[model samples]
Target: MDFNFLSPVSDLVLAHNALLSSQALGSKLRIHSKNQGIPDLDAVGIAIIGVLENRNDVNYIGEEFNLNEIRKSFYGLFPGSWSSVVADLGDIEKGERVEDTYFALKSIVSALLKLNIIPVIIGGTQDLTYATYRAYDDVIPMVNIVNVDCKFDMGDSSKPMKNNSFVGKIILDEPYNLFNYATIGYQTYFNSQEEIDLMDQLYFESYRLGEVSNDISLVEPAVRDANIVSIDLNSVKGSEVSLNQKFSPNGLDGKEICAIARYAGISNKVTSLGIYEYKPSKDDEMTAMLVSQMLWYFIEGVNLRVRDDDFADENSYQKFITLVDSQELIFYKSNKTGRWWIEIPFLADVNNKLKRHTLLSCTHQDYIDACSNIIPERWYKAFRKNSV
Candidate 1:
C-alpha cells in the first residue's frame, strides 16, 4: 500500500485518453493522473507500473526513454468481454542510483503481491527482473521463474550486475528462494558455453527457439509452473518489432510472443509479469502496438482462466500410471480443462526445496512418451533437483 514511489501518468497520455471512445480499454481503466492522484485498488486485479530506470543496462549510454507511447496504444484498444478490474499506477522515475530504483521496484511489487494484486511491469531494462524476483524473498518460500528470451542472461556472478547478467545475481543472492528457472525461445548462439553448462549442472529447464516456434504449446507447461514471468522484447525477431526493439534476426515472431504472453496470463500460479528492454525511437508505433496487443492477449487469457488444477476430487481429474525403465510415473489429466500434469514424488529424507509431493505442469505428449519408456525431461529435472 506504500506507493509513494510512483508518479502519475503524464498529462499527454491522459489527454489522449479523454478522446478515446467510451468502450475503449482506457475508459474502463482506473488511471493515476496529476489531478486524481493514484486510483483506489479496492477491486483491482491487475496494476500496471512503468519503470524508467535502465542504468544497469550493459549498453546504457545515458539515453532517455518513456512508456507514454505504449500507454497510448494500449488505451486506444477496445476491451474484450472481461470482468477483471485493472489500474495503471503510472511510472517510477529513476532514483539517484540504479540500486535505488531496484529497491523501489521491489518494495512496490512486494506490496502488490501481499494484496493479491498482480503487477504488470513495463521496464526500461531486462535486469529489472532481478528486482521482481527478489520481491518473492519473503512472499513465497519457493519461486519458479519462466523467462521468454533469446539468451540465459547468466553472466559471471563475480562481476557487477548488468541487464544481460542479472540472472546470475538471482542465483547467487541470499535467501535462496529460487526453486526452478526455465528459459523459452533460447538461441544457442546467444548464450556462452559456460552459461549453457551451468544451466544443465543446475538442472534448470530450457527450450530452444526452433522447438518453441514449431509448437507454441511447449511454452504452456513452463509458464504454468512459474510464479514470475519475464519477457524480453528483443526475443522477437528484428523484422517482427521496430528497429529500436529489434535485437536478433532470428527469433520468435509477433504472434508467437503474444501467445507466450497469453499463456503467462492464463497460469494461476503466476503472480507477476514483466515486459522489458524497450527502446524508444522516432518510428515506434509498430513496437508500441505490438506491446499493446500482447497486453491485450494476456488480459484475454486471464479472463479465460479456469480452476482445473484441483485434483482432490477423483471425478475432477483422471489418473494414469505408467512404468518406464521400472520407474513408476504418475500423470493426471484435468477433466475440466483437459490439461496434463506429472507428479514429482516427495523425498522425505533429503533437504530439498519442495517439502511435499509436487505436480509439474506437463503436456499429453509427455504422458505418451512415458508410456513408451521415456521420462519427460521436466520430470527428470525436478526429480534430480529435489534429490540434490
Candidate 2:
C-alpha cells in the first residue's frame, strides 16, 4: 500500500529499546518504517496516526510542531489484557498548504475506517477534527459528534476556519451530515453567551465543566451515542501538563479526561477519535504520560465492548413503556451492560434522515422521569431534530 501522505517514524525512535526489565508497548506494536512498509489492517483493531500541523492553534505563533514525546511516552507503557492488534501508522507531516494536510488526513482516516480499524489521532491542532468529521461525510449519511473541550469551538463560520472555529465549518458545510453535536467539560467562562444560546436553540447538548467534573458518568451516555469523538488537550488544567500554553486553570483533570476517553472507546457507535491541541515543551514527560494513559484507557474500553445493538432479542434487553404527558415512551435496558435507551418516534408525514423511530441513549433517571409524566430532555430534543 502506497500512502503518499504518510512519513514513517524515524529509525532512532523505533529502534530505541534501551529500557530493560520491562514489557513495553513498542515490542507489541506493528509500526510503520522504511523496511516494514504498511502494517496489515486485517490484523489490526486500532491505528495511531499523528498529524504535525499546529498553524491553527491559538497559542502557536511559529512553525514548530512535534509528537515525538508522545510516541516515546506511549511506547514505553506496558500492555494490558488486550487481544486487539495496534499499529502506529507514523505521522502526516504538515503539507505546503493546510488544505493539503486536511486532504491527506481525510483520505487516510476514511481508508482506515473502511477496514474496521479505529484511528487514534494525536494532533497538533483541534481543528483537524473538522477533517476527521469530513472523512465520514460520504460513508455515513448522518453522524453525531462529541467534543471534549473547554470551549464550544463554534466560531464564525463566515470567517476563515481555525482551531477554535472548525465546528462552525462542520455545521455550515455541504451534505449536512451532522445529526447531533455534544460538548463535554465546556467552561461557562470560555464560551460567549451567543454560542451558549445557539447550542440551546439548535437543541444540541452541552455539559458544563463543573457538571462533568462533578459526575464523570454523565459523559458516558453522550459519548455512547456519538459516532466520532474529539478531545482538545486544552481542556485539561495547567497543573497536569508540562506545556503551559495548552493548559487551562480550571478544566478537566487528568483522571476525568482519561475516564471520558474510555467512555468514548466503549461506545459501539464511535469509529474515530482525535486528541489535539498538545504543545510539547522541553519537559513534556508528564504531558506525554497523561496522553499515553488516556490512550491505554480507551483501548481497555474498546476491548470490553459488548455487542448489545440487537434490541429485538428479548433475552438481551428488558422493555419498559411509560406515558409522559399522554405520550408513549419506550425504554430498553441492555442485560449485558445495564445501559438504558429511549425510543424517539418519528411522524409518518415527516421527512427525516433517521428512521421512523430511533433509540437515544439515556439514563435510568430519564426512565424514572418518564414514569412521573415528565418528558426527558433527550427525547424532546431528538423528537424536534428528527423533524424536517
Candidate 3:
C-alpha cells in the first residue's frame, strides 16, 4: 500500500459538521487521521484523495491550495441512498519537484485501481490529469478519456508539460495507450485554430458547450463510453464560482456540470475521475460547496449504476440492424434502462484492446439518424480507430 505517500486529514476538518437534525456526510466518512493508520481499502469502493500541487497552472503561479474547505463542504452534505462504502484517504502534499507529485499521484491512483477502489481526485491543476492517464498503462491495454473543459488542452507537446497542454503529453508519450480522446463543453474561442484542426487530424471528438448545454443528454454517450474522465473546474461559468485562474465567461452551469459528473459516475468503464483547476479563495464558500456537490452527485451515480455491458444476454436487450451506405449498423437497446449502444465491427488480427463487435454507447437520436441513412459520427470514429 503506497499509503505512505499520503498525509492524514486534520481532526478539525473531520470534526466539523453541518447544523442538521440528521447525520451529515462528515459524521459518516472514515478518515485517515493517523500517520500509520489509513482507511481499510476493502471497506470502501470509492476513495477520495486531494493533490496540493499547482505549479503547472499557467496563470496561477505560486498560489497555495488545500482541500480542507472542499472536504468540509462535501462532508457537511447529506448522503444519498447509496450502497458503496466511501473513505477520505487524505491529501498528497507537493514534492520537491512537480514530477515527484505526478509520480506519487500515479502510484496512488494505480494502487487504488488494482484494489478495485475508484479514486475521486481533487486536483490542483488540470496537468495532474497526465498522471491519472499514466496510471492506466499496465492496468489496461488501452483507454478512452473524456475531458470536460472549455478548451482543448492539447498544447505544444514538444514544450514542457503544463496544465494548458498536458493532453499533448498523454497523446504523444510512449506505449501509445490512448485510443480515443473526447472533449465536452469546449468553447471555440479559448482554443487555438491549430488545436481545433489537430482534433480533426487525430480523429478525436470535441463537442461545443452550446451543443451539450442545449441538450444535456448529448454528453451522456461520450462520458458513458469513457474509461477515465477529467473535468476542469474552469469549464464552469465564472458567475457560478470565484475565478482563481482558467476563468471562463460562459461555460456549463452548475446543474449541467453536475449532470455530466453523474454521467461519468454511472459509467461502469470509468475507473478514475479528477476535478481539476480549482483554486480555493477565502471569500467564496460557494465554489467549495459546488465542488462538494459535484463529488456527491458522482458518488450517487456510481451507486446507482446499472451493469448492461453484456450484450450476449438476449433477454436483457433488443438488437436492431440497419443498412446505410452499404454498411450494416448494429444497435442495442437495454430492456432495463432503455440505454442504447451501437456496435462497431471488430477487425481480426489487429492490435486492439476492445473486444469483438464493440458496443459504443449512443443516444436514441443516433439510432434515428442511422435510419435516415446518416452514419453516426461516433460509430464512424470508433470504426476508424479500431481498424487502425
Candidate number with greatest lDDT = 1
lDDT of 3 by residue, 240-320 (tens): 896464377799999999999899889989999999988877655878988998999999999999998787788999989
Q: Stretches of candidate 3 above 4 Å error?
A: 18-22, 243-246, 349-355
Better of 1 and 2 by TM-score: 1
Question: lDDT per model, in order?
Answer: 0.93, 0.88, 0.88
**Model 3 residue 329 lDDT?**
94
In candidate 3, the residue pairs with backbone N, CA or C atoms under 3 Å apart (3 or more residues apart, or in different chains) clash, namely none
Show model 1 residue runs off by greater than 4 Å. Answer: none
Tell me the tens digit of each residue's lDDT in model 1 across 142-199: 9999999999999988999999998999999998888999999999999989989999
Please write out the lDDT profile of model 2 over residues 92-112, one tens digit for every residue: 999998899999999999988
lDDT of 2 at 20: 22
Model 1 pairs whose backbones collide: none
Which TM-score value belongs to model 1? 0.99
Q: Model 1, residue 242: displacement in angstroms?
A: 1.4
Error in Å for residue 9 of model 2: 1.4
Query: What's the best-to-worst order under TM-score?
Result: 1, 2, 3
Q: What's the ranking of the predictions by lDDT, best on top?
A: 1, 3, 2
Report the C-alpha displacement of residue 94, candidate 2, in angstroms.
0.4
